[model samples]
Target: MKRGLMIASALALCTAGCGGGASGTAAAAPVPAPTPAPAPSPSPTPTPTPIASYTPAAAAIPTAGIALPLGKCVNMGNHLEAPNEGDWGRAIAEDDFTIIKAAGFTSIRLPVRFSGHAAMAAPFTIDAAFMTRVRHVVDLATAAGLNVIIDMHNYDELMAAPDANAVRFAGLWKQIAATFAAAPATVWFELINEPNTNLTNAKLPAIIAPALAEIRATNPTRPVIIGGEGWSGIGSLATLPMPADPNVVPTFHYYDPFAFTHQGATWVTPTPPLGRVFGGAADIAEIDRNLQTVRDYIARTGRVPFVGEYGANDVAGVPVSERINYYGTITAAYASVGVQSCAWAYTNTFRLRDGDHWIPGMLAAIHTTTTLR
Candidate 1:
């Protein structure tokens, strides 16, 4: 017998043969089994729209003069880059600018997380209050005679889904450019920071051109910085694409001999091993070779390079003296080549300052440029 027929017969027999209560009410008709619903069809994936590419003009505009003012810089990190100003434990204070100026620093690279503070939909508006807050910091830095490089930092969504976010990225820049339009030339823009993942060397030019266009719409001729994929490391620069615009500056970060510079850095996967102290003849030679690679790139491209970030971690396992030696070596090497550099940070990881004062000898280690003093 069929399974359904067998079940029906078994229920019928029980209903007929089983005795009812003394009231003799017939057993209620056996409830029917419910039919299962059909499975849902899967939604189709949306195809990504292709982004337009840029071609540099026959004669590239010179960027060496554009990149000179950012001497002896330092990143004011772990502040506006956080989801909230103080979420990373350091907020930009008014006096912070005064202190930075007193330390002989000529520029401050202010990193802001624009995506986190902006709407993700059409028009992609950055919050007005947050924009104002950023302006306040910029005004404070410039007033103290510090050149401010307002960098678009930590846009995780764009790195993950470039095609989906490109328009929004451009939208955010449209607002940012207009906001700083009237500001002096000392205020600069770094289009995006540490691009990686879906933002490949092949895709970066398409991504940068639109944002650069937006900036030029209002602030033409202002210097804008751009870095390559793979977290802006030296290897990344090998294929970095530049838009035809003359004022764009090429940037890269260095933490070479990574095992030593990033020792005990909890954030890096498998964490670089602890106790990898720096300062050997081989170590010194490696720094020289890397800076030479930068010089070679500059010679080939006429775009003066900026060391946007370079520092060794201040960790429990490494002595302060060794860290200072590494800083002195790296900064002096870049200065020798006339490539301006900004250390990793002021008061966070790889910090030059502690509480209110700079770590002992840390300021002098990086103050290798006579122009900076």
Candidate 2:
């Protein structure tokens, strides 16, 4: 979930009261004009029809534990998720996958703004060309021996108006599931990236349930990742609704101690100033406490968590060393408790690359592997 912010305004309501004359009118009063009847209260919008229950073709169901192998992943961000690829100054290159695999990453999270490329009306057909383009990229990554997380990202309209867009959301997934139904299990589906705005914690179940139902129709038992609202921070886990389906994996994003991780992030309002430093003992302790929350949640609920995104921006004034320490500490912290994580990006603000090569120590820091404590 790229952090550019957009807040939606609340809809305004207006009401009018009907006026009537008293039965005992003054003698001088002429026939009072007939009072207009108050307009019938507008009918409440009916809830959308839920999808019919469907059993997976037995052959299509996968065995358990398929969603947990997401070790040492990195996000391929600011590319397809942008309103248009290359609009954010980085475009996916075939070799980029090769580089990531070589750098010791096990998977890649590819965020896509499908809403921008799909028809706005019923069926919400994704543009054929765009769909093919996404497949081409995913195929390239999987071919490079990297598991790919195909995420539905940047669906701002759906976030702002979940009820109005719920059908289109399901339609998009129906098409996506059918397209990848036969692909290797290495390809995964992430329901929506960092859901926010009107899609509150309470409202998320209604929005995601239909999409999951549609996905199971074709990709039964394949892992589907779901994250909580409020930008999917760790705390959101407390309120996130876990669907009854066994294959759904709970996910969350972390960029905690925001004063340190997002020190100079321009997209954040009242942007945190530059010059923040991390890796003090307290910082590391804070990281542990945060991750402990995830561990506790897993223990309490029996659902494993995936760190869908985490990183510190390499902004000016924030030392490169501090950024590296943040990555290493965060990565190792999650690993310490048996959770898998994907760094925020490969390039752009929080880049892990310098042109064709890994940025000096960045890879070594984030790629540190630790046995679960």
Candidate 3:
């Protein structure tokens, strides 16, 4: 979703790679669909609603649907990498965390770009003291009864480069994983943020293993999320080298027809082509394509697909109706398929368009309990 010029929606901004600060990732090309098939929705309703502030013991592989207890997870947004939280990228305002939990989101995806800190080494290992700051915020979120997905935000900048950079990136994960080995189940590891196609499954574990192994060594049962190549785009999901452990889930970002969704993005080639408002048929169309990938993946590998990131930015006078429809379509799509999703973010960038305690109606896609059950 990188745009050449910022669109003037009521919302603010985002965080993708590094100082390279390109438009956030466009979904990498999806692997070819096997045979177009009808889309599927899981249609699950918990016998008892997942309790708020409930913590479950960490499991190696999570149960595949909404029944497992993960309500809805949104991003902590700017506090980690946006200009507002620049130093060490470790700060989190208590108010921000409260806003998220209050909004009905049960989890927070904390993406941090540690490389910005001068203290980082070549492979971009996060500094120790900075990690303490990270742990502190994590404590705040978990204490608030929210699940946390600690992402290694952006490391491929060094990874795509040669020598010490790759080593540093690999080592950075090891350091992080080792540090949080004892973290609660609510705090899961989302290995390296989004990777490019160049990182084939064959080569993935090599870079991922060192870090994953570090975590497994300490907490073998904790679920760890891993994304596919093609900048970890949904299309690239089919090629994922999902970890052997059942607790592992294959993850990818969903931004279809990037040309449309990322209309003005400069980092992307051919920029975004068609211009479509958020929601309805486009939502259905988007979900259709998504479930095709999910069913296709399930048919082929029996593994489930989850959206690590998916949402529309409030740019270019994008209507609240459009946002609401878009999110509604998304919620229905995921609910029907039984896909467990973590929507885009909740912050200054691509945020929920807060109107005091109320998030904008357009962003309030979750109009029903079914959306998160």
Candidate 4:
């Protein structure tokens, strides 16, 4: 009876914060084990699309340049909340963009997840209304001249039923592509966000290739950024064959040696230990090795490398300066190879460098470029 009471207490507390998720059969996958990437690969096979006749309008130059400027971004976590998707307005105001713009960020990454609507197919339907709420943010970013990258964030079904996953992923993309059919060049369609250890990076191209074909079928030549698996690891991206679309960019994320970045992050079960130290000198060495894997691939493949997300956690003990310094190291590696990048976020989560007050300094650090500086 006493144990039952404690279980009830725990359940009530979890529901209070991030609205309880329905039970998931997906167990956490393997930790990032080091796997040597295979030989320098050829481009992926081309798949046909229905819209073969459609030529993209005068292509808008992608924000990616040989050396991308330090653009800022935030991950938008909530979309369809409360009563309706329309009611799903930003808890923070539009005025926040003023601060963002002033801080010198030129982009935003919107992370949205929706399900249970019919259009996304049998297992998922990220209701059309829900997508509209997300569109509003994209519109706002474009109005502000900030590039927007819209992504399917936190979808769980694929991870649970690996066999049936292809239909679920492909259907979601078809629906999303049809819904956001007219996004401007400045807006990007990211196929998936951090498919990670859950989906072997090997499975990504098969799932994503069909969707890429689907998107181009409607709107030929919109830029698509593909995040790699194994939690979008820099080292792991080397293993996955990047889908080749003349306009597509191979995307990877960084939160490496997570002991430092996610220290004391209570979100995971079996709480990660405190004093989870890393980010001393050796990290740079590891980063260099990782960057080389990417650099070599890009040189071999001629595809642009986009570091879609990179950031440091903001523990009270870890001064924001350290985070900025970390950026200097990672971005420089990207810059050295002429790779473009977008920082992890614009919002202030305990883990991300906060944009609330210190954004100006952070911006100064991130935006430093040989030409711009």
List residue ranges in candidate 1 displaced over 4 A: 1-65, 368-373
lDDT of 1 by residue, 1-373 (tens): 1111122212221110111111111111111113312322223322322211212112222444445477678988678877688766567888999999988888999988888899988799999999999999999999999999999987877777788889999999999999999998899999987666577778988787888899999998999998776567676677888887778888877766665675554443334556665655566666667767876787877787777877776666566877787777777777776666788778865788988788998887774444431
Best first by lDDT, ranked: 1, 2, 3, 4
How many residue pairs clash per model? 0, 0, 24, 6
Predicted candidate 3 versus true structure: per-residue lDDT over 27-93, tens digit per residue: 4221111232332222232232211121112221224421224557676655665433643233467
Q: Estimate the Cα RMSD of every predicted model relative to the unseen true structure.
A: 22.5, 18.0, 10.7, 13.7
Span of 10 residues, lowest total lDDT, candidate 2: 13-22
Question: What is the TM-score of each predicted model, taking all chains together?
Answer: 0.81, 0.81, 0.74, 0.71
Tens-digit lDDT string for candidate 4 (1-373): 1111121211221110021000111112111112312222222322321211111121112333222232445444333221223232334456655655665677666665543344444645766566776677677777777777777665555544445677777777777777768877777887776554346677776677777887888768777777665545565555656665666666666655454454333433432344433445556566666656765766666555666666655544455655666665556655555555666554434223343465435655553223321
Q: What global local distance difference test value does model 1 have?
A: 0.69
* Candidate 4 clashes between residue pairs 3 or more apart in a chain or in different chains: 73-346, 74-346, 117-125, 196-230, 196-231, 313-351
After the best TM-score superposition of candidate 4, give how far the Cα of residue 321 lies from its true spot, in angstroms: 3.0
Query: Each prediction's Cα lDDT score?
Result: 0.69, 0.69, 0.55, 0.51
| TM-score of decoy 1 | 0.81
